[model samples]
Target: MNKTILLTGVVFGLLAVVFGAFGAHGLEKMVEPEAISTFEIGVRYQMYHALFLLFIGLWTGLKANKKRIVYTLIVLGIALFSFSIYGLALNSIIKFDFRSIAFLTPIGGVFLIFGWFFTGYFILTQKRIN
Candidate 1:
């Protein structure tokens, strides 16, 4: 589970850097400043969650079942939150409608919030090794 989460985190981090650079360079010319800013936000959040997942992966004492749930939430959060923003940001260029799925961003945010909260709760409740 830990290694799986770690790999997921690495993938996300790599994509974040790629998207961030694309936003800073390629996107600026193709999209409006507002769109680029929005894309950048997606990149920022992706990077944040990526790091968070990485940390959680390394943190000790989590049982397998609990780890699965936490990792799932983080993964879904990235897929919904970050990817939705990426689509929204690129909508201008791609000319696709994202309004129907706009609600997903906040829902994804909620998942991420819950993920962190659960992680904290897990840490607090865990028996400390002497």
Candidate 2:
């Protein structure tokens, strides 16, 4: 599970960088400033969650089950939140209407919030810190 979390973190982090670069260069001329800004937000959140997963992978404070919960929530959050934003940002150029699924962004955000909350709750409730 730890290995899975670590690998996921690395993958997400790598993609964040790739996406960030694309947003800065390739997307600058293709999209409006507001779209670029929105895309950047997605990249930022993806990177943040990637680091969160990396830390969760290395930290021994949380049990396997707790780690799994966080992992699931975060993965889902990233998929729905960041990916949806990407689509929405590109909607102007793309044939598909990303606004159709715009509701997913906030739903994903809720999952991310829950993941963070659970992490803190689990750690706080633990009998030992170390």
Candidate 3:
């Protein structure tokens, strides 16, 4: 599970960099300034979560099950939140209307908030050795 989390973090981080580059370069010519900003937001959040996952993977304070819960929430959050933003930002170029799924961005944000809250709660409650 730790390995999985770590690998996921690496993948997310790599993709974030790639997406960030695209947003900075290729995306500028294709999308409006506002759309580029939105795409940048998605990249920023993806990078943040990637780092979060990397930290979670290395931390030994949490049990496997607890880590799994955080992992699931974060993964789902990224999929729904960042990816949706990407789709919406690219709506001008893509065939589908990303606005149709705009509701998911907030939903995914909720998941991310819960994941962080749970992590803090679990850590605060954990018994520390003297």
Candidate 4:
């Protein structure tokens, strides 16, 4: 599980860098300023979550179930929140508008927030440090 989370985090981080470059170079011309900004926001959040997962991977003293929940929520949350924005930002080229379900970004944010809460809970509940 630890290796999986770490590997996933690494992949996410690498992709964030790739997508950010794509947004800057490829998308800058194709999209308007506002769209580019939105795409940047997606990239920023994806990178942040990727780093967050890396931290979670190194963290210790958490129970297995709590770690699972946090990891799952964070992974899914990053996909939901970041991917929705990516789709919306690229709608002009992708020929698909995901705005109909734009509400997911916040829902995904809630999940990410809950993951932090769970991590904090685990830290507080644990007595011994390794």
Candidate number achieving the greatest lDDT relative to the actual structure: 2
Worst 10 residues of 1 by lDDT: 121-130
Candidate RMSDs in order: 1.4, 0.5, 1.2, 1.2
* Per-residue lDDT over 1-130 for candidate 4, one digit per residue giving the tens place of the 0 to 100 score: 7788889899999999999999989987788889889999989999998998888788776656777899999998898898888888988887667888789889888888988888888788888755
TM-score of each: 0.94, 0.98, 0.97, 0.93
Task: Write the number of the candidate with greater TM-score, choosing between 1 and 4.
Answer: 1
Model 1 gets an lDDT of: 0.88
Tens-digit lDDT track of model 3 for 1-130 = 9999999999999999999999999987898999999999999999999999999999988999999999999999999999999999999999999999999999999899989999998889889611
User: Residue 27 in candidate 3 has what lDDT?
Assistant: 86
Against the true structure, candidate 2 reaches a TM-score of 0.98
Clashes of each: 0, 0, 0, 0
Per-residue lDDT of 9-72 in model 1, one digit per residue for the tens? Answer: 9999999999998899898778889989888988999999999989878877788777888899
Query: Which numbered prediction scores highest in TM-score against the true structure?
Result: 2
Any idea how many clashes model 2 has? 0
Name the regions of candidate 1 deviating beyond 4 angstroms. Answer: none
**Global lDDT of each candidate:** 0.88, 0.97, 0.95, 0.86
Assess candidate 3 and give its lDDT. 0.95
Candidate 4: give the clashing pairs. Answer: none
- Cand. 1 TM to true fold: 0.94
* Candidate 2 Cα errors over 4 Å, as ranges: none
